[model samples]
Target: MTLELTPILTRLQNMLQGFLTAIPNILIGLIVFLLFVFISNLVRNAVHAIAERAGQPRGIALVFGRIASWAVLTLGLLVSLTIIIPTLTAASLFGALGVSGVAIGFAFKDIFQNLLAGLLILITRPFRIGDQIVSGNHEGTVEDIQVRATMLRTYDNRLVVIPNSELYTNRVVVNTALDKRRLSVNIGIGYGDDIAHAKEVILRELAQIDTVLKDPAPQVLVKELGDFSVNLDVRFWIDPPIRREANEAQDRVLETLKKALPAEGIDLPFPTQQVLFHDQTEETDGHRTRQREGWPSRGIERDPRPLREIRPNSEEVDNRS
Candidate 1:
């Protein structure tokens, strides 16, 4: 029993001696790590302040500061670990970290992709906060842009969180990108109404609206001859291209047209159709010019016979029976 216990006791004593001898180094490593932590915080704050002063967006500044702080902290950690364990060489530490990094990258591939995509979006700035945009099947006002996702508050006041990778890869339509946006309203007048006079009235009325921009000038074009009326397309520009403003301008334009066009003797006609019934077995069935309802009047063709003068032939009667 004594011989067996001797080796265990000897190993314990050596471990205790080694620990006691390394106390000073451990203390020094801890102090260095704390000092690095302090310096990293200072670096983070400094980077954030500098970025803000350079007119960077708040979110972008925050991202930059976080990256700087993490880098400093990682370096500090590596240094402290080496100091605490003299056997840990720089090459060994780097090799371990490289393998660990690969594993971590594989584990969180989507997260890293979103981070990179978010960084790119902030740098490129396709759309800013408060801009109304349409992406994929979602459309809303951008509330915030974060490191992983973009927040949107929809027109109906619903919140949406979209990954930055999707925004970067997919198509996005920025509705309010321009200073002024054009809007069109289609109005139809009766075929008998004078097209030129109707156009003049519409243009004059549109110019009177306060929201309409006067620089580009409103346009009135004859769109097409509709079933019951002649369609006219009225187009005009409005400033501060927003959904609310666009809606209000459209409402005002429509109201003005509805009220002013009729006061100027322009007619807004309703859809109307005339359908006629005739017997196919009549003498005028195949006579183009003599057809009562569908054919034009011709000098060589006689008028169609009255309904009282026509009757169904024997074949049609027998079939019906």
Candidate 2:
């Protein structure tokens, strides 16, 4: 009985020693994981605070903070795994990543392209935040630039999310970048009216508008000879910083011109036509005359010649003076 007890006790002691040795490793791994999690959360909170202080949107800040925290935690987990299992190494991880790199690239080709374009836009700064811009067919003020798309607030108050790749390739028109912009109005005048008088009236109206810049002065030029009138091009410089005010000023100027010009007998051009009907009959002198059946004639004697007596002549008349 003593010999059997000794063997059983020896086996139990070996099992207890093995458990004691493994417990320390398990505890160390757990501690490391907890420390990494704590640090990640701290960094995330700090990042969010910084973004908030910098006037960044809370949503964007939270998204970036989460991404950063995930990246840090992933690195920490990889480190912990390596420590726990000595067989797993950075070289093996990189080799596997390289083997699958092509598949990953193909899967995220569009996403990578948009990310690169966004980076380029941020670096080059062709247009900045809150800039009124027209890119491709969309016209709006830029709100933000993210990894995938750029946000724009249209003039109508609609939010537009455009992909960055399209912006990189298409032309972008920045309307508010310059301090001054030009406004053009097409005006028409009657064919017989005095163009100079029309221009003077237009200039006077534009002078009353405060939003128009006086230094550059307003320009009036004859643009085209239209079907029934003369077209004039009225161009004036305006302060870009007050674009809405400038537009209102332009409208006022046009309205004033419309009213004042008409009052001053300066007629604005409109389409008109003058038509005449002719008779296919010729007099004895082979001269064509308008047909008037019952109208009194002037500067000619009323001859009682019969209508059938009228004859055609081919001889040409020499009336050179």
Candidate 3:
């Protein structure tokens, strides 16, 4: 029995010795991987800084940095793997990846789609970080563009994460795409006021606004003769055309127009409705129709009180009847 146990013990000792022999190599590989991680991080930050200084968009810089970092880290991981397992070569690793890529792609189809879209966005430059945009139901400033999603900071201060695939495939409205934006305000004046004078006052008031663009020249045209007033559309252009600025310009214009129009004897009209009594229900017995004012003559009584104070004479009532 002792002799039989000696062979089994020898096999166990051999396996333990092999594991101990690989321990140092495994430790060295882990150290090398840690060094690669540190280097990759440094390179990522450096690339980001360089790209930003070069006047590229933040999203573009981020993409460049992330790609660089991931590439370096991937290389390091492969090298570490080779060190840990001497028999596994880089070619074999990549070959195995190629073989399994189809299954991995299927499992992460949406992720790949967004990654591709993110790359396209960084290249095409539709809208940049900090630009206000509207896509589908989302309207907000672009916070950041990521590997698989785009982040938005809404006006109400909520963060939204949207898949890049949607943004690339759908329409996006960039409000700040142009240096100047056109704005229009409708003003209604009483029909009795002078149309020409009202227009002149509006244009002159618009000229006083500092934010308004003068090159295009503000216009005040009669949109229509409304029910209670003459509707005039006061269209103008504003510079540095952000939503906030445009809104401020509009407020100033409205306040000035209101005061200016009134001072010029142009009354801002209120909604008014006119009623006509046609007297369609009139008593006509093959003769002239009843007149409204004299339907009951002035001599007739319109008293509606109950007669309880005086008793009428029976004979007088009989004679009048």
Q: Identify the candidate with maximal TM-score.
A: 3
Could you give me the TM-score of model 1 versus the true structure?
A: 0.74
* Residue-pair clash count for candidate 2: 0
**How well does candidate 2 match the true structure, expressed as C-alpha RMSD?**
10.9
Instruction: Name the runs in model 3 displaced over 4 angstroms.
Output: 1-26, 49-55, 85-91, 275-321
lDDT of 1 at 127: 91
For residues 159-215, write the lDDT of model 3, one tens digit per residue.
Answer: 999899999999999998887789999999998999998888888878888888898
Give the clashing residue pairs of candidate 1, or none.
none
RMSD for all candidates, in order, please.
5.8, 10.9, 8.3
Candidate 1 structure lDDT: 0.87
Residue 252 alpha-carbon offset, candidate 2, angstroms: 2.0
Whose lDDT is greatest here? 1
Cα-based lDDT for every prediction: 0.87, 0.76, 0.84
Ranking of candidates on TM-score, top first: 3, 1, 2
Q: Supply candidate 1's per-residue lDDT for 179.
A: 89
* Count of backbone clashes, every candidate in sequence: 0, 0, 0
